[model samples]
Target: MAVPYVKGIMPVMDQRVYVHALLDQFEARYSGAGGQFRYDGQAWFGSDYNKLWLKSEGTVGTDGRFGDGDHEILYDRSISRYFDVQSGVRLDIDHGPTRAWGAIGLQGLVLYFFDAEATFYFSDRGVAGRLTGSYDIFITNRLILQPQAELNFYSNSDPARGVGRGLSDIDTGLRLRYEWHRKIAPYIGITYSNMFDKSMFFRENNGKNNSGVNFTFGIRSWF
Candidate 1:
């Protein structure tokens, strides 16, 4: 009798990678005491439902001095069509001693097409939280308007870093951009930022204005 032949099973291959970046806040402040630069961006790689994500944001003075910055690497899992649950480690690099925190965050698109992110962090110093929201309005195929806001809170004061407990600060801005291409756009806008509660006191003692409106011009791009 002839021996029976068997078929070999093939291994599954379901892998993908993606990269995206944005210069969310790269502009010059016209009314501020000094020029400043800010940036926020992220990149990720993974399969359809799971990914390794890295995010970073920072602010600096034009004199080439670093101010405040945070970096996070997280495992992101898609929980729904519009949201992702992320848990990771966050590192704060600023004027004071570097601190590490456990971070958990939610990122999603909400009703009325708003992009939102909320993250909570805890470290030996204390707990902190950040909330950000933004929306885009289209005026034409190439013209767009964006409004954005961010709020920060802390549980304890850190004099070395000029941070205070409770509600620390809020920043709001509006930008109008003309896209030369889908991946690049130039924008002009105005921003209003203010410190609250003990955070205001810290600014006062440091001879800094508690609030101001600034005119900004910059470019927003992604790839």
Candidate 2:
């Protein structure tokens, strides 16, 4: 006797991974009398519904030599269509007492256009929070303008890191770029930064200015 023929169906799963490098900033500061570089980027692995995420950002000064800077590393989970809730760590690696922080944050696209992030941090020294927002405007098919702002607040003074209670600092910048390709664009911009409250006093005591402007020239890219 011959058995009846049958076919088995198997479930299919979709999986993918991606990496992007965003907001690369290299600029010369007039007040600090130095050059600075900054970068923010992320990578993720897994399926559409769930994934492991890694995000990082850092800044360094280049006056005569390269030195340590403030850096962050975060792990994130996508909980909604437009947002990710993240938690990780931050390290202040510049010319002061090196301090580590526990970080929790939300990053996402708002209203289908604006990119925004808000993060809170806790350290042995104090509590801190940072909020950032940026929007892109297209003047033509290839030419684009971006305006960005970041504000930082603290719950206590951290003289070791030059931060203060209440609002610590605000930074704003405007950039215009012509996309040479979808992956690369050289841009020019200006940034204005100001420190407030006890943060200003700390700067003054350290022989640094409380506010300044920077001229930025850099390339923004991703892959």
Candidate 3:
């Protein structure tokens, strides 16, 4: 999986600028490889805020195994500094299981234990959705800690061709990253995904949620 990024407003400007690019690969008996590139801009409109962004990423293997790339457009509004409402569309372009979808996210970054997102999609395969939540604590200026999890849910499948995993998956991970001057950072982390037990989708598609660890090393910066 690629590094995920979110942008709102910064303390310095009435409106701020941020851009990031990330790459990650997991190699093992089961390998999943992917990366993400994004550009975001946000500004304040009186009290309500507005943002627009574009991102592209993909994943393969099992955890870092074989997978495809996904791209998306995000537009959102922030009711306040700590709370926000967002809506975005995602599409699979390369090695597609091509689909288009929307989502919403909530974050309390200043506080701990509370970042979440829910997504619903109309895919070429079927209708599906996922819910993910995470908690984070900044241990120091150079170190930030994150614990996260995800659940995938699917509805309707092609039973005859044996297509689609009508199951939900659970993933848990501990991530740590170091930031250098708020512009560039290198990080490494690990995760375990349990894809088999929760839903028919995982069981049927043979999308087993074998636990795997991820290692990521890359540069993150903006101008």
Cα lDDT tens digits for candidate 1, 112-200: 97999999999888899999999999999999999999999999997666678988888889999999988889899998888887778
Badly placed stretches (over 4 Å) of model 3 are 1-48, 62-68, 102-113, 123-126, 158-167, 197-223
lDDT of 2 at 149: 93
lDDT of each: 0.82, 0.74, 0.51
Name the runs in model 2 displaced over 4 angstroms.
Answer: 1-14, 30-68
Q: For candidate 2, what's the RMSD?
A: 5.3
Best by lDDT: 1
Clashes of 1: 0
| Lowest summed lDDT window (length 10), candidate 1 | 9-18
Cα-based lDDT at residue 218, candidate 3: 38
lDDT of 3: 0.51
Q: Looking at model 3, which ten-residue stretch has the lowest summed lDDT?
A: 36-45
Predicted candidate 3 versus true structure: per-residue lDDT over 28-135, tens digit per residue: 222363332212122222223666645454444434433434566666667677766666777655442445566555433444537766656665556777666777
lDDT of 2 by residue, 1-223 (tens): 6545556844444445555455445444444565566555556655665555555555555433233255777777788989888888888776667788899999889995799999999977788899999998999988999999989999999776678899998888998888989878888888887889899888779654426788877777766
Better of 1 and 3 by TM-score: 1
Better of 1 and 2 by TM-score: 1
Alpha carbon deviation, residue 200, candidate 3 (Å): 8.1
